[model samples]
Target chain A: MTTPLISAAERQRIRSGAHSGPTAGLAPGHVQANLAILPADWAGDFLRFCQANPKACPVLAVSEVGDQALPTLGRGIDIRTDVPRYRVYRDGVLTEEPTDIAALWRDDFVSFLIGCSFSFEEALLADGVPVRHIALDRNVPMYETGIACVPAGRFSGNMVVSMRPMTPRDAIRAIQITSRFPSVHGAPVHFGDPAAIGIRDIAAPEHGEAVPIEPGEVPVFWACGVTPQVAIRNARPPIAIAHSPGAMLITDLLNTQLSVL
Target chain B: MTTPLISAAERQRIRSGAHSGPTAGLAPGHVQANLAILPADWAGDFLRFCQANPKACPVLAVSEVGDQALPTLGRGIDIRTDVPRYRVYRDGVLTEEPTDIAALWRDDFVSFLIGCSFSFEEALLADGVPVRHIALDRNVPMYETGIACVPAGRFSGNMVVSMRPMTPRDAIRAIQITSRFPSVHGAPVHFGDPAAIGIRDIAAPEHGEAVPIEPGEVPVFWACGVTPQVAIRNARPPIAIAHSPGAMLITDLLNTQLSVL
Candidate 1:
């Protein structure tokens, strides 16, 4: 059968185990969001954390407790099934990676769809600024920083950032371009001297493969989607569910619709 | 004698006196610009230079040859005498710093009012971001960079940047804030590592006083208004005039008017 036109409902149907896999390169131009579902008791603090650290945890859509529909992000998106892969966490420890969460869905759970770097990368590419990771066919390098995110209750951690190698001029232009999309990680939180922010080595990335930094290129970093995941780990909600790294909830919303500017 | 409200009309009337000293703190909230008047023969190349290097030469207003009126930028702005002070150049050398240039105004001259940092600094101050130069009561530091500006005709030189020091968090916010005003040096060109950009010493500024960069504060640099002056000197326009450093041409346009978003 020919690959389907990948609408939001179609993706959700696939996520329901009509199919199951990574969501990258799935829906083009539409927003694919990082997902985090948490207990209602811990939801307030996580919301506050997201608010306090907006760059890292840009909220695209938040669903009511126990409600599966994220109407704003997509038409008839069932958060429990729309995401292709789910990582179950219990007391901050990973418990399982499931294809479907229907059996685990709880009345006290609230879902959040955070803006992803994919949207910004799309924007960067459209603007003619090469995103080194996409060009090299690798994941963007991510690092844990010494810079602390403002704490909210039990949810607190330093920002996690994704790095892109580009010339200083391109970096400046990238900053100007990204600032237009505040919902998508905004601008680079820190650049130059990775060790200054506690990253030990430029080539030795903590999360993803490092791309080649051309001569005269600096590593420009943006607050990452993984940051809220860090806060989730810190908050240690009795039970939490997140989309697997690189696996995301495909939303019908256009990326351009998220720009505050 | 009491200071009249100095309507923009009134200010222009007073400035046409050809003997006013400095134009600082005058025409508050309205945009002020750096003047760089060049011979008509060199105007096309200078225009290309400004286009190629927009961050440094944000041309807010330009005048037709020998016409003193910059109708778009201000009400009845005469390129000849409305600016409080003017510097005359001969063979790329400063020949005079005259208050009035009507005596020296040539029929073949084309005037350019480049956007100045005062507009963005005003925006920053209004946003409650403490500008170190304003706080310490000193001029902002300026330095020549190893970063060569994109060459246009005879106009090509290293960029000159103005520096301000801020903590990383504040720097991030400032980058977001300034990116809104593209006409006025939209965003910072460089931050951290003064040496990386070829500054021999951060404390020893080439042009203005160095404000203290406290512990943990990274130096942020913006493409400066002085950049055009450097290019003008390099281009060696036979008959040119510019505003005395820091003494800009205060216009009737509000700073907010320059913001595209």
Candidate 2:
């Protein structure tokens, strides 16, 4: 049986156990976030990374050192187990993707929840602009660009961009809609010539499946959360963890509430 | 001789004599608008036309039957001769380009002042966004798009778009800035490939001179005020009048006051 859409409290309860899975279509209209955890020793650098590269890592909430609770982000959020799923990293390499992070918890671990494009995509869809990849039931196409992010501490890498094919009219409206939600990717970074930003091929996305573009449409690009993942790998932190792609943390905050105006 | 920038009263004094000339760079910081005077019998259709295409024809003020004064837009404003130049048309064909229209004033005339992109372009330049056309001292590149506007009554045509080349980063920021001034053309209608909208060549514009596109820059397109002129021609009104291109009516209203937020 398909699981019914549940309330935030109930969803958190499900996530507290072994029910970790993709948070898509769950808690509709509520904001979903990407999780990034690091040891306190590396927290300062990672925090700098998020601040310097806000489009890819819009920091929604951060917990103090040795703290597992993030009261500001949700109602009694247990950072160690609240995420639907998590990736565990050891010596800068992903070692495991687990449903529950209780076993991997450390006293010095700090948690950060970042704003995700899922929120702005929902906003765009609500405003009647069709999101291509979502209509085709595929992941949005993402690629690594030659354009470099600002280096902060030990975190820096070429930016990762997500692409959506749209007619020029819809693309303009999408830019207006997404710009209001600056915490999530904001307006598109580039359009038309993908190679101008260093992507060699339009059909060969480095991170996600490519969707078909019509003859009269252009591929609009936005900064992607994967940029931070690349930076994390480059930084080579002793220990780090992040939510697996598409497996985000469904939060109590409503997406509408994230709009600055 | 360069005339001194003057107030509403001073401009009115000069206009009272039916003085006609180009109104470029007049009354600095004050808003200038394009005029469309249609018979009262055809006013509703033209209103619908403007509503169907707000970006091209943002209605700033409309005068009542037999009233030539545009009080809302400026003090003691007379639609008959306030503008520096005018183009009078009959059966959709240009019949006269007069500076003063006191002799052609009619009781059935209903005047409209639509927002012009000049106001927002000034704002952009002031904000340090490089406006290529202005820098090159030429008209902005404009194209006839294959995209049809929402038809209203007898007024319908493909939209006209103006182009400027900008880097991806500035385009993102420009999107945010222009969104605040909806009274103007608002946000860009398109960007990137000109051919997507049936523009065969970016280097050859239908109206205005083409500006160079830097290696990493993309052409950003905004719905142009010329769009309404195209629609007006399609409507083929028995009698019509508009401000000559770049020869708008200087008004007392400040451009900054037009920001909705």
Candidate 3:
């Protein structure tokens, strides 16, 4: 069957349990976001963490306490049912992956829609800069860096970065293109030697599949959406939920709307 | 005596041969440009070259043939007498260094005011990023790279790049800051290994003095204004003129005015 044309249509398919796959290439021009749901008591601290470390956790929109709808991101975006898949965490440990989290919805839960790298990746591709992982049909390689995030209450951890192999020329263009979309991780946090940021082995990433770094290409890194997961793990608040990796909340917001330029 | 705060006053001093020194750090917050003058016969090809390779030869203002006044770049500015130093070339050979080019001005001469890296360097320094060469009181090191400039007519040569050694963190910030000012060699061309761009000896530059690269620092290269001079040499126009090394034309245009954002 042909893919749905508009975001609301695609979201309806996801909401109705007709689409449970990763939402990477769906809703071509819209913003797909990283999700984080926390208890209201822990939400204030998490909000502060996002503010303090905007590069990694750029909060696109935040839901009111106990509200499942993110009004700012889309029309009737019911957080509990709109995402294709969800990861439940209890005491900072992964409990289960489910198609829907309606049964586990909490009144005190606050939802945060963090900007995703997909927005900037679209920009890079549009500008003729190659995204290696996307070209190879593999997930972007992510690594845990030694760089520390600014501590906010109980949320603190080393920053996680997603790597994309590129020549220095393409990397420069990528930096310029991505800088326009600060809401989506902005410009790269690091480039060149991976060990400089404490990525010990370039081939073996802490998360995602390894992509080859062709000859004369450096591994350019951007702050990843998984960073908040690290923060969530550190700030264990009894129970929390997030979208399963690659199963982002496909919002009605256009990706171009995120560009500050 | 304290330096004059106004660009017109500074230009007057330069016109009277009172301030015949390096234009760097002078007329703070104003645009200083690399000056290039060619006969009307060779101007079309050179203009094409500048347009084809804007990162290296960003033409901020171009003069009408035989008109020494660059009214667009500054108020009442006479290119022939306002520059602190001028180098005249005959058949691609450096023939003389003159404080004023009024004696050599020809009706067929067409002048171009090209953007200089000084505009972005000011932005970097203001943002608290260390400019190594500025701190050491040395000229920024420039090297000829194997990267070729897009050929326009007879003008063709490898690009020349200016190097700045910075830690990866500061380099990322520099990339963002410089990207805002495209006229001033926007963003870096390459960072990390010098050999990657064909620079055999980082310590020894073909033009400008070498600055020390501290531990944990990588050399960042930007397209240099000297690139056009190399193009001029390759084209070998019978009569061509340029600002001597370190000497530039201080224009009334504020550096911030050059920022695209």
What does DockQ give for each predicted structure? 0.45, 0.64, 0.71
The TM-scores of chain A alone, one per candidate, are 0.93, 0.92, 0.96
Residue by residue across B31-109, what tens digits does model 1's lDDT show?
A: 8788999989999999999999999999988898989988887776777777777888787888888877888878889
List candidate 2 stretches off by more than 4 Å.
Answer: A1-20, B1-24, B198-206
lDDT of 3 by residue, B1-261 (tens): 233258888999999989997888888988999989999999999999999999999999999989988888888899999889998888888889999988898999999999999999999999999999899888889999999999999999999999999987799889989999999999999988789989999999999999989888889999999898898888889999999877899998899889987
Q: Give the TM-score of candidate 1.
A: 0.83
Clashes of each: 2, 0, 0
Candidate 1 lDDT for residue B23: 51
Sort the predicted structures by TM-score, highest score first. Answer: 3, 2, 1
> 1 or 2: which has the higher lDDT?
1
Backbone clash total, candidate 2: 0
> Rank by DockQ, descending?
3, 2, 1
Which of candidates 2 and 3 is the stronger one according to TM-score? 3
CAPRI quality band, candidate 2? medium
lDDT of 1 by residue, A1-261 (tens): 212245665675766587576565667777888888998988998899899999899998899889999888777788877777899988888889998899999999999889998887888888899998888777778888878999999999888889998876677778877887889888888766688787888888777678888877778889888887777778788899998877788888777777766
Q: For model 3, what is the alpha-carbon lDDT of residue A175?
A: 85
TM-score for candidate 3, residues paired by index: 0.93
lDDT score, residue B119, model 2? 82
